[model samples]
Target chain A: MATRVQAAPFDLAAELAGFGQGPKVGAVVTFTGVVRDDSGTLRHMEIEHYPGMTERAIAAIEAEAAARWNLVDSLIVHRYGKLAPGEAIMMVATAAPHRGDAFAAAEYLMDYLKSRAPFWKKEFTAEGAEWVAAKSDDESALTRW
Target chain B: MIDVLYFAWVRERIGLPKERLATSAATVAELVAELRSREDRYAAAFADLDALRVALDQELSSFDAPLAGVREVAFFPPMTGG
Candidate 1:
């Protein structure tokens, strides 16, 4: 189990090294979120987070996901600060004995991280900057679990 | 004294990140009320309670929750993290 909140970019390859290698682990699922510029006018994206609460909240979510699934290992690494378009924002990796458990646990971690985490995103476009609003769909997604 | 923090637009509008305040407000709502009464900046930042979320002692909490032993209170908009 590992949770890292940093401003520096993380290498997906380095993060996955030796991951999900235990004898009982058969399935490993990974998800990565990238900074996208759909409008083609974005200058950058700035991410703000409550330092103390951010770590605590994410660790709690990870703990919950572990409790809900049979897992061998899990990792969550999120980035804060300015990120250019196409930059990797964050990633989650889950390893379990079966594909079903790995997939479900990864999804569960994402759904909770979307709304429960303390990070906030603001987009700087050609015209101005605006804070990204939380989506109602993201909140409702939690009801599925 | 309790540490009060504002984030995102709440921090921008209020023009600061955090402050230590001595208050007798019994709940989060009352603390908000007291801040709102301070000046235009606080009032404007807290004009709509629906747009804001609060945390007590770093844990997400409701505005009606008591402030008995909370050492930190944070106010911010809904999270957009993933």
Candidate 2:
């Protein structure tokens, strides 16, 4: 498992392909999160994450997933710095011997990351900027794991 | 002593991204209370506990959990960390 925190866009296809070692690992689940334009409702969004802590936190999540699943490879690419609409913001890929493991692990990582990781997102709208309210649904998702 | 970190909205409210602190708190909740007592900034930052999340030594954990032997305690907005 690997987690890269950088200011540049990542190549998700290449990342997932790298895990293609032996033929036994047949499944690959990839997720790409892109910046979406919320019309004028959202002018822009600011993402804040702990510098040293972001990497450490992400690695811990990956490690937990690796231990719980039969995964062969996993990659988490999260971008920082100023970003615009339609830009790639983050990606997650999981490879395993079976699709079920790969798919579930990838989804699990994403849901948990959204709810448990230490990142804050502030949205800029027509009126002004505001922190998106944390939802109860997100916390409930953690119980699924 | 531990390196305490704040991220996202927590940083915005606290006006700092990171800080170091020596504490007597035995649990994360106690630390949060300690921070809230420090100054107006910390009080404002930690005002809404429901909107906050915590990590001990970089691993997400409950606020009531012990932090006696931890190396770090991180406070942040409910994560959008993907």
lDDT of 2 by residue, B1-82 (tens): 9888887778878998778899999998899999999899999988888777788877778889998889988887777665
Count the clashes in each prediction: 0, 0
User: What CAPRI grade goes to candidate 1?
Assistant: high
| Residue-level lDDT tens digits of model 2 in A15-50 | 766664777788888899887876647666777776
Provide TM-scores for the models. Answer: 0.99, 0.85
List runs of model 2 lying over 4 Å from the truth: none
Proportion of native contacts present in model 1: 0.88
Candidate 1 Cα outliers beyond 4 Å, as residue runs? none
In Å, what is the interface RMSD of model 2? 1.7
Give each prediction's DockQ, rounded to 2 decimals: 0.93, 0.67
Candidate 1 residue-wise lDDT, A73-138, digit = tens: 999999999999999999999999999999999999999999999999999998999999999999
Task: Report RMSD (Å) for each prediction in the order shown.
Answer: 0.6, 2.4
Q: Report, for every candidate in turn, its global Cα lDDT versus the true structure.
A: 0.97, 0.81
